[model samples]
Target: MSRRAFCERHDIDEQRLARWAKNYPAPPRLAEVVVVGELPSARSSSLVIELGQARVHVERGVDDELLARVLRVVGSVC
Candidate 1:
């Protein structure tokens, strides 16, 4: 049924419903994603971050500043 029909059947004020909807919107819908390529193997010494079209491999004992810089660059590009 249409929103108007629903409101009419329930005796709900459309203006109030509109205000409530604006104040409390529905949660976002998530899209379904399919992985076409093989994922990297999990290693004890490193971590992998997938960002859109970019993949970040972080090894153990990596410098914080360097990782931040790389993430920043990848984030911008991806």
Candidate 2:
């Protein structure tokens, strides 16, 4: 059925629905990455993680708990 009819049946304000739709759009589409060169060696000191459009570079000597927390937060948002 129509959006207006559905909202009316559900006791929702049409204006509020419109505002929510305007404020929160759909999630973005994911893109594919192609690597042409050689990958990093196993002896590299740092590690890189690609989450969505975010690139997290973690160096050596970082705390494991702190890194886990950071990844959790970044993962939720990204």
Candidate 3:
């Protein structure tokens, strides 16, 4: 989904969205970082990190280490 669409749908702040986009995990190819307000299971906020040209779901988990690994892969791709 487009950034605008995602932000609007989730009622996310435009500035926060911009920051997320700018501070994407190290990998250039795996660029693009997004934080969801709810995890869908219990509405608990969780972070989602994606990679690849189209953000082809490299990894997903609530743990920071896992997310970091995913970003590392993305960084290597960069």
Candidate 4:
């Protein structure tokens, strides 16, 4: 059955339904999904990295680039 016929049979107000439909539009479709990189799982215990009174607590599976920069700063200064 058509929407109008169904609405009529169900005793629904067509004009009110049409107004609501116009007011709230349907969600847009997603054209494509891109996966940049999978996130690492949380570690059971945090890893403590000490740097001369300054400490940085990190979880497991940290990015290599971040680790490199941190080490360079600590090693260069100390």
Candidate 5:
């Protein structure tokens, strides 16, 4: 999805998402699945979870069961 669309849908500024995406590391760690109705201040085209010292971007329509599984892995590693 385009950055502009993401910002509008989530009520966030596009520039911030761009900067975060640029600064974000590869293979992000998904330590948690944050439940947000929306992200107005988010700084990326996708959804991101900030788990203590980790940051993870969630793709469109991620499955809840899968998310829980991923978080389980994060818990083990982190």
Candidate 6:
């Protein structure tokens, strides 16, 4: 990347960038990726909501309105 392009992209002053470059030369380092938390590795996660004897197998990407309606109908029975 050119000095002009870098400065323009970062909204940095040219003179300040030049001074910083001279003062603090970038150190050679290997690229690293840090993962904080472990994610659930389930193949298919479906919400099996149980209300008494009713077992509603709600799959992912189900419409909110439709889910609500289904729940309301389920609640009426239970």
Query: Tens-digit lDDT track for model 3 on 1-78?
Result: 766886797777766656544555542242344655644454435434444462534333444445545556665685
Q: Estimate TM-scores for all models.
A: 0.45, 0.46, 0.31, 0.36, 0.38, 0.43
Cα error, residue 69 of model 5, in Å, equals 0.6
- TM-score: the better of candidates 3 and 5: 5
When 3 and 4 are scored with TM-score, the better candidate is: 4
Displacement of residue 72 (Cα, Å) in model 1 is 0.1
Best by lDDT: 2
Candidate 2's C-alpha lDDT?
0.65
Ranking by TM-score: 2, 1, 6, 5, 4, 3
Find the 10 residues in a row with the least total lDDT in model 1. Answer: 22-31
User: lDDT of each structure?
Assistant: 0.63, 0.65, 0.53, 0.55, 0.59, 0.60
Model 5 lDDT per residue over 1-78, tens place: 577986797776887556445443443332234676765444545677666566666776565556655655554566
**Model 3 ranges off by over 4 Å:** 25-78
Q: Positional deviation of 66 in candidate 6, in angstroms?
A: 0.4
Q: Tens digits of per-residue lDDT for model 4 on 1-78?
A: 665885697666877446434433452221232423553345345566565676676666666456655655664575
Q: Which stretches of candidate 4 lie over 4 Å from their true place?
A: 1-45
Better of 1 and 4 by TM-score: 1
> In model 4, which range of ten residues has the least summed lDDT?
27-36
User: Which structure is stronger by TM-score: 1 or 5?
Assistant: 1
Name the runs in model 1 displaced over 4 angstroms.
1-43
Model 4 Cα displacement at 41 (Å)? 14
lDDT of 6 by residue, 1-78 (tens): 777896797667877556444433352122233434563245556656766589787887676557655756775698
Over 1-78, each residue of candidate 2 has an lDDT whose tens digit, in order, gives 576996797767887556444433453222354644666666768867788898889887666556655766787799
Best model number under TM-score: 2
Clashes per candidate, residues 3 or more apart or on different chains: 0, 0, 1, 0, 4, 0
User: Cα lDDT of model 3 overall?
Assistant: 0.53
Is candidate 1 or 2 superior in TM-score? 2
Model 5 CA lDDT for position 55:
64
